[model samples]
Target: MIWTIKKAIYRAMHGSLKVMMVLFNLPEPELFTGAGSSLKIPEVVKSKGINNVLVVTDKVLMELNLLEGLFNSLKENNVEYKVFDDVSENPTIQNVEDGLKLYLEGKCAGIIAFGGGSPMDCAKAIGARAVNPKRSVLVMKGLFKVRRKIPPLFTIPTTAGTGSETTIAAVIKDPDTHEKFAIVDMKLIPIVAALDPELMVGLPPHITSSTGMDALTHAVEAYIGVCGNKLTNENAEKATKLIFENLEEVYKDGLNLEKRNNMALASYYAGVAFTRAGVGYVHAIAHNMGGLYGVPHGLANAVILPYILEFSRKDAEEKLAGLAIAGGIGTPIESNEELSYRFIEKVKAMNKNMGIPSSIKEIQIKDIPLIAERAVKEGNPDYPVPKIMNQKECEGIIRKLLP
Candidate 1:
């Protein structure tokens, strides 16, 4: 009876929220996609009328020379900037505070988020803090909690994943609690996004595989999730097809600029899809794994994705079958269930080919209940997952992934 009441309350809340979002008609960022799109950063900066900017990045991207074009563009345009390169793989509240300090100390007029999701998330948090200086970042943890407009922000994604460039959500961790939370608001979206495949050409194969799978997960979940609309469904289908076609090629030959560009577009499309439809249990569980075990976000999602799909298969059978057709994994004659199984098999095969492990060896059996509880709390009433698992069912999925 308690579960039934909770579910009813959630359904009512979710429906109301959806209605409000539809009424709001929020706007997304302007996107530039191509081989050398990062070179347009200075132009965007100039257009936004920002002279001093904060560049949020990580050490590895700087060391890899991925920011050469961006920095050179800023230099040529005579734009002064400060760099905060201490963002971690799973950025923490402390990281956001540190970046905010840099932003304030440097008196930045805008922000340039450079690198993957970590830097972008940190940049968004910093921007949010800059706008609401008196408010705690913790207070901005839930949907539409950010009430004010953030500073003009531009995103240059160095990897072909995470889609943080186009999304209005930022996931930040709390060190004290060892938990991850999201700051979701249209105000947190970037003013511009540059998807330059040139920066992704030198990415390590393992990173490429994992990040590509992250994009795939986004597309799949968006399609299967209940909130999907016509536009989001179309974007998700195209993104899934692009990932299926180009991900392995990009993984094998990272320097193939065409395939790299395709993957980048795929990630952006998937980002757009999920930004509206929202992601499901895969991300909720993966976020917990990152907070507790320090698992890389993309790898954790990749490892747990197939299991979630299997668990949700009954609820999402028709959608899964459609994805199987879209992904070129099934024929028109196949039944929905058969096609869904084939699609799941295709995902497993892709993971195997990309060398993703079947299970995470670090997950302890004792942590299953805690993770499951957290996952349910995180996903329920927010994500439009086709199947909403209880704590016991969530634990079963976790056990399957445990070594």
Candidate 2:
């Protein structure tokens, strides 16, 4: 009876939050897409009267010379830029502080996030810290805390996942507590985004598979969550279909620019959907894994998605059936029960074929309790999941992933 009452209260809060989001009419980034879209950004930055910029990215991408074209374009456009390539895989708060120092020293007028999610997240945090000089990143944790406007922020995603380019979130980790949290506010949304498939064609097969699955998780969680509206549902459905059609094809043939382009679009759509509608326990759990074990975010999401779906399958049955049909895995004539099971099976098959493991080797038996606590804390009263799980139930689910 107590649990039932708590769920009812949670549902009421979710309803109120959904109404507020619809009325707010959140904005999306101005987009540049296709094979050479990233080069267009320098011209736009110049037109915006941004004389100097900070480019945030990871060292691996710098070593790969992946940013060579963007750098050349920035030079040609006369946009003075400083590069901060110290961002980590999960992007620590220290990375943000270091980047902010570079932004200040370079007298940068704007920011260009030029890698995967880590760079984008680090860039967003730097912007937030720059504008709100008195507020620490830890203080800005949770919703609507960053009231100040960030500098002109532009994002270019090298990976077709995380959708950090389009999302109103900047996920950062604290090294001391090993806690990963998000700073979610409209202020963090990028002013512009470039989706260039050329930059994605060189990604390794494992990175390609994991990131594609991450996009699918975003779409699935958004569509089945209670906060979804017409726009989010449409975007999620389109994203799901595109991911189903293109992810594996691109994974097998990483050089296929057309398939890569499709996956990029799918990631953007999923990002847009989840930004407004909210994601569920998969994200909550994945964030914890990234924080605790230093697991890559997409890899953790890829491994945890199927387990979360199975846990919520009964409650999300009709929605999963709809997604099954939208993803071209089931017909409209199929029963919801059958379709739902088929959707879960399809996710399992995708993981298996892509060489993603069913269990995470980094997850230790002793840490299950802590992970479950943090996951439930992050998820409940915000995620609006189809089913509300307590810590005990969450522990049971996490235990399955122990290797």
- Lowest lDDT block of 10, candidate 2: 17-26
Q: Which pairs clash in the backbone of model 2?
A: none
Per-model C-alpha RMSD: 1.2, 0.7
Q: Give each model's whole-structure lDDT.
A: 0.91, 0.94
Across 52-147, the per-residue lDDT of candidate 2 in tens digits comes to 999999999999999999999999999999999999999999999999999999999999999999999999999999999999999999999997
Off by over 4 Å in 2: none
Candidate 2 backbone overlaps, count? 0
Q: Pick the candidate with the highest TM-score.
A: 2
For model 2 the TM-score comes to 0.99
Q: What is the alpha-carbon lDDT for the whole of candidate 1? A: 0.91
